[model samples]
Target: MNSTNNRIVQTWIDDQLDLYNLAKQLGDTVWQEQIVQTLYNKEQHTQKRMQQDLWRVFDSINRKMLELFGQLKESSNSYEVRVLREQVWELKLQRIEIVKKINK
Candidate 1:
């Protein structure tokens, strides 16, 4: 992923963590039903956004893989192939993390 996307994902992860922590803290408080419901709605919205982001990442990775495969087919450069393989591995790892976060 590019630096901008990386930053955005990291920021989102941080925000989710903060929200989770807030929910835990509020669990002991005597908040009204409306306040709790609002927080729940916000959490749901965030979750949907995260899922969309993950799908976008997956789509980007798919396109990159396709491009790399085409390049590899056209050239016999071992170094370039190795680099592309490494990038695919990185993308797979990122996908795994995104899946885990979404499951949470």
Candidate 2:
């Protein structure tokens, strides 16, 4: 791959890594446990649905990252690599927006 495409893919990988770390930290927060318990008691149905939705988003993001990795591994031309890199960049931006909405 060309240098530019390599750099773009590297940035996308870094962003994904950052997100994985963020999710880990958020999951480990003490307040999260309290929130979960409260929601479980007061709004079990809504809480379960919300959790399912969150898991769906998390799984989708992971799948997309793996797909990007596969594309990077199989890319045979600079053009293909650049296209894959752009897709990853767009995915990263969308993931950030999803996180913002979830946090809100």
Candidate 3:
């Protein structure tokens, strides 16, 4: 990503991270680039690992979203449909973040 796109991704991730804090659950990943704080070769390795993890998480989220999609199509209950829609939306956002932040 370019600097502008990268900044947008970082800001979105930070915003999501803050939401987890309010929910009292902070298991979200926090990966950011810093020149001085990182060791020369180690920084590249760490970024690769983080990107791999994000890919795995993205796959899991994709599976869940597809499962929900089927249920969403078949559901007749308005409330259940609403809940499913929200879940799918949240997963979609996460997927977007992963795609943007991951090494391409």
Candidate 4:
């Protein structure tokens, strides 16, 4: 995964903790919104493989989100359910951000 993306902006998907069970693998500690601005750009001109990698990460996040949605529906109203809903929303935002960045 080492590339210009790592050296300059340091936006390694591994570093996003919200991606822990969502991504296939996870490490490091970056806030969900604290990632670099380049990762938010719609046409950053990254390598084709980089875009593919982001898609893979996005897909993984989507899978986790689907599971969360199922649990949200299956459970009754409560503080725990509210927490799960919040998590689902965060994952939704993460997925959208990934989409915006990978159009290059």
Tens digits of per-residue lDDT for model 1 on 1-86? Answer: 45655666567666755766675787834444444554557645555666787778777877887887787778678898888778
Which rank order by TM-score, best down to worst? 3, 4, 1, 2
Show the lowest summed lDDT stretch of 10 residues, model 2: 39-48
Candidate 3 lDDT over residue span 5-95, tens digit each: 4654565555644554654453333422232223334435456656776788899999999999999999999999999999999999989
Report the Cα RMSD per candidate. Answer: 9.1, 16.9, 12.0, 15.0
| Candidate 3 Cα misplacement greater than 4 A, ranges | 1-40
Top candidate on lDDT is: 3
Q: For each candidate, give its TM-score against the true structure.
A: 0.54, 0.49, 0.57, 0.56
User: In angstroms, what RMSD does candidate 3 have relative to the true structure?
Assistant: 12.0
lDDT agreement of model 4 with the native: 0.67
lDDT of 4 by residue, 1-104 (tens): 34556643344443433354343344333433344443454135345547777889899998999899899889897987999999998998998888988874
Shift in Å, residue 31, candidate 4 = 44
Output the number of the TM-score-best candidate.
3
Q: Which portions of model 2 miss their true places by more than 4 Å? A: 1-48
Q: Model 2, range 1-104, lDDT digits (tens) per residue?
A: 44643554555555545655675687855555554454445444444445566567866986998899798999899999999888888878877866765564
